[model samples]
Target: MVRSATTAEFRADLHAWLDVHEAELAPTYRGMGTLDEQIAQMQRVKAILYEADWMRYGWPERVGGLGGAAALRTELGASLAARDLMDPGHFSLVEVLAPTLIDFATPALAAEVVPSLLNGSEMWCQGFSEPETGSDLSSLRCRAVAEGDPSTATQWIINGQKVWTSLAHFSDRCVLLTRTGPPDSKHLGITAFFVDMDTPGITVRPIEMINGVREFAEVFFDDVVVSTDRILGSVNGGWAVAMSILPFERSSCFWQRIAYLYQRLQALTRLSEPTDRNAEIIGNAFLELHALRTRSRSTQHRLAAGATLGAETSIDKVLVAAGEHAVYNAARRLLHNTITLDDTVHGEQWRTEYLYSRSATIYGGTAEIQRNIIARRLLNLGDER
Candidate 1:
């Protein structure tokens, strides 16, 4: 029976389920466990949520969803984070990449692929930033040339390199964007495709970041063949598809993450020593998180109301980055030596997260680029490039 519960009802029901499932969902491995273990744990939790139909809400019925208010999914993610069932940071890839597939992939493709992702039977990665194209993504150099028999067949042969591909080494497929036009084509002639990671001539090498964790990877594609049927949206029309992906990344994803950050801040407050400095830092972090949560609420409402987000959502991205940085900075200020010099398990987790927070300004879009967007597009200030 489909339980079309109200938000309050759903929350109560989910809480009850969690009370029983807590033991099963608890992380068996502590600090610095293998990435394989983390991923396996993520799948275990996802499978449970999917079977409960909590994972299906907010998604389309055509793609194995239950077809409810988007808030249902948001609440589900929040519950998972609050319960510490999964790492909010890593689980966010679904919120980032799934909507892109739903909006851009063919109906057949969405039906065939999205279930694998939602069920954790498969993992997907986004191929956006290259070495020289992090902030200026439109300037990517990955090339895709049209190929196959001219009469009845159509395809593209891709050859290029992508860097900073999050989870690429573990991904089963990638939502990739490649250049199909001249060097100066910019965003105009770019195309998007769903490419198999295990396809012939594709290589993925893990890139170790400052934290000594290889969470992201560099991917190389040489003569990677993709059928025209795999092309998302249209040949030169990928810019729109890419642009449409931003709202979910910025807003819906931001809300659940904010909830997780709040939980962490509260935990930090509990762990802090008795000092005025610690109190001030905790207060500041809390305020920043509060502002972010408020802003995020409106964005989530907009999304659920079916409004298309644009340059304005960049504000949400900025708030998220700032709030995340602030929270981690508070940890550093309060925990002090533990995060820096200590080699304990908890210290390592805090240290890793702090270093990862440095990239908060860089990922999704840089803090600089986001500010520029707010100035030009939202405030109607001077033009920025």
Candidate 2:
């Protein structure tokens, strides 16, 4: 077995490597472009990191990685985010989905597919939320029924719709959730599947965001037949698979986002003149970012220590949304007319980010929903419903 490098050692070695490879890894694009371009750029960066073995660290050996502490992966994301080589949100999708695959996917299946995602050879999307079921994921209506007798079925037929599926249009695969029981079954009846995008009867339609980027999409399944082997977990146990993904989404994924926010904050300071009001605004944003980072650091450590994270991670989600809004709000305010009028790269960037920040509270579980979870599950205050 390979001995894992400590966080400090990993940081030193990674920083040294980044310095040597900075020129090669630097993004060629200047400001926000189409989602396709951004994703392609992300793949380019991941390929380089994978070739150098930086992307393989912290993942299990069975999944085509050089086994090491998970913190190495977190640190790698931070490094990439700080340098603006990858979009933190898109870059972190792997962190959000891959672990669930490793935990629930068959050993053979995981080994066969996970390395593609890790090395950026393919992209996958999370098909969790439907048009009527964003926060109330248990109420998802997408249906997946076994084609033959349950005992001897070789394939499952899926039919339904999923909206707000991030990057679904560009994704090669999806970790989809579907109702397998009676409509009233809710959480208990849902099942998860790893479906290929090329599967017949699957349709992907892009949705343009206010930022002028097609960052999300609506996916429809009409008699899409999938091998039973694609089941992520036991039938009717998708809630567990989803539950495992949420903690990572709320915690591990936020590390890179926090790093990116800090980088944006620094840029905002550089753009603003040193005024009392500007100082106050920047200071408050910094504090929020700091709080988020502090909370997220704890969550990361817990995950690294192999703890099963639960509702407590709701706090991390809340802080991340708050910090994101604060940072971009500051940019909108401090940049003044430039943000509102100028058409330069910097101005457009600020405008785009400001608009995108509005959705921070909406994605990764809404702020209202997260607060409810904190109150009911973490604080034992009351029932969410």
Candidate 3:
């Protein structure tokens, strides 16, 4: 299927549509809103866009989308972020998870669930990190045992725990990882599953962050019975599935975040009184953000051209974390005591964002881990010990 509009044309038309519908799309809460408010506002905006056909532009028609290059959806999201209609990180999750389903799930299953995600009827979470394993993904112990013969089993019973799963408590489904192989099998013996979160014997408890938001969760699966049909990719090929998601998460998903940061930077400028030191700091932050956007733009184009992204996106991961920290650090520097002391809604938002921004180096993948990937995979400088 072909997209009817050019990228620039789509951008112009989307902006015009948004201009006309500003009142309808505006959020009811102040500043960026709490996590609950953000989710509600995001879903409300998503449903409106889906209804108006704006949300369907980049996704395949088989998934209830109007087919086009995936980059078009990035444009949609960047625009929303620029205008403050939707949270960029929340909006970009489709790029991270939906494509995984399309590429790995049975066509019938992908067709059934992907539409629900795009239309704001369903939310999904990734279940990869564990309390014991952390970023050492191959050490995952969330076991899934076949109910009968391994080769022909129709049911698998899953039992284990997932920690730091973002929004698991609110998610309708999960793209989960399980240890299908032996305990010592490591990376070679995992599998991915598209499991319904409402299934019996599953529990979710949200984890409150330093920023006072319960954005992450601890999820437990106890003898949860899932059909063989729910496997995302081939058995023991979940390592491949895991690799496929990181590229999207680090690169494509970060584009709209760049837009969000740009907007926040502009807001920071408005709040700060101009000083010589402030000028230098904001200028440096702008340069770093520009670098991130330029690099991420190339990644989005590569995805548009159907290029396979691999360890190279670790560069994107590094830049996004760096850029995020730079922006908020600049905020703390320029705004000073306001960010640290104010208890007002507006001031609290800045303080919370500043706190959250500090964790950029830890989530998705750590800075040290990314630098190791860059050294080992991209630069070819390091030897494995």
Candidate 4:
């Protein structure tokens, strides 16, 4: 059995390991690459980390992890992001999806598949948002119906569309949400599934982002037959699964994103000349980033302590979006012509990142929606209007 270590011990050990293996883990292409290339690079890095046992820390033993506190995993991701070894967004998918699987899927199923995801042998995508149901997840229309008697059904037929599914084209499986109850049942009618991406009747069409990468995809499911054993959590209990995911998305995933933002801020400082305007911009951005990091750290500890996170995480979401915008906005202002018109590698990178940052508020629950959540759920204010 792998020995458990405190956060400090794990950090020191991981940093030393990274320092020694930097050459083997570093990406061949930096700052500029297609989405596929970036994904490949992330997988390579994950494979090496998994072999070194770093990726397994903080996860449960049942899921092939080393069974340390969840904070350990966040630190690993942060260290990687700080060193610019992996794209935090891509590296964070596991943090977003694996926990849901472990909590909701059957023990056997989780044990069988979570290891592949952890070890970099396969990639998975979350299938939640539909074309018409972005933030209003309760109104999703994806349909799943049992092909046999409800009590003994062995298969389910699913037909629906999911948009904005990150990394769908490269995924081996999907943690999908479908409406299994009456048409208007809303949240109560939903069910979650562990689906094979290669299953017949499933199609993935990549969508190119403003950043010039196909980071998102539209996934279509038509008459897709899935085994009953693939069900995650109780039938028609997908809302709970989705709720569980929100906290992780808003908190744990942001740890690495925060590290990435700090790296960008450092780069912006280095590229721009020392001027009052640049100084003010960087300083304001730094403050926002620091606030986000502090809030996110508290959330991580709450999660590690086994607290059930709910509307409280909306605050984290709002802060992270704000911090992301601030950092990239500063980059746009300081980099000036390079961000606007230059075609050099550094210029392209700044431009691409700036464009992508625009979606930070929109993804993982929009800033407006998060505010609504905070007002209605957290603050006991009136319903969202």
Root-mean-square deviation (CA) per prediction: 1.7, 1.6, 1.5, 1.3
Question: Which one wins by TM-score: 1 or 4?
Answer: 4
lDDT of 3 by residue, 130-247 (tens): 9988779999999999998978999999999999998888799999999999999999999999999999999999999999999999999999999999999988999988888876
Greater-lDDT candidate between 2 and 4 = 4
| Candidate 2 segments whose C-alpha is farther than 4 A from its true place | 1-4
Candidate 1 at 177: error in angstroms? 0.2
Point out the worst 10-residue segment of candidate 3 by lDDT.
1-10
Question: Candidate 2: worst 10 consecutive residues by lDDT?
Answer: 1-10
For residues 1-385, what per-residue lDDT tens digits would candidate 2 score against the true structure? 1334788988888888899989998877778655677899899989988988899998999999998777888889988999888899999999999999999999999999999998889999999999999988899999998988865799999999999999998899999999998998999999999999999999999999988888899999999999999999889999999988876787767998999999999989998899999999999999999999999998988987788888888899899999999998898888878779989877888888899999988998899988998888888898645
Q: How many residue pairs clash in each candidate?
A: 0, 0, 0, 0
lDDT by residue for model 4 over 1-385, one digit each (tens)? Answer: 2354799989988998899999998878756576778888889999989988999999999889888788888899999999999899999999999999999999999999999998888999999999999989999999999987856899999999999999999999999999999999999999999999999999999999988889999999999999999999978999988888877787779999999999999989998889898899999999999999999989988887888788888899889889999999998888889999999878888899999999998999888988988989888899755
User: What is the C-alpha local distance difference test score of candidate 4?
Assistant: 0.91
Q: Estimated TM-score per prediction?
A: 0.96, 0.97, 0.97, 0.97
- Of 1 and 3, the candidate ranking higher by TM-score: 3
TM-score of 2: 0.97
Models ranked on lDDT: 4, 2, 3, 1
Please provide the root mean square deviation of candidate 1 (C-alpha atoms, Å). Answer: 1.7
Clashing pairs in 1: none
lDDT value for candidate 2?
0.90
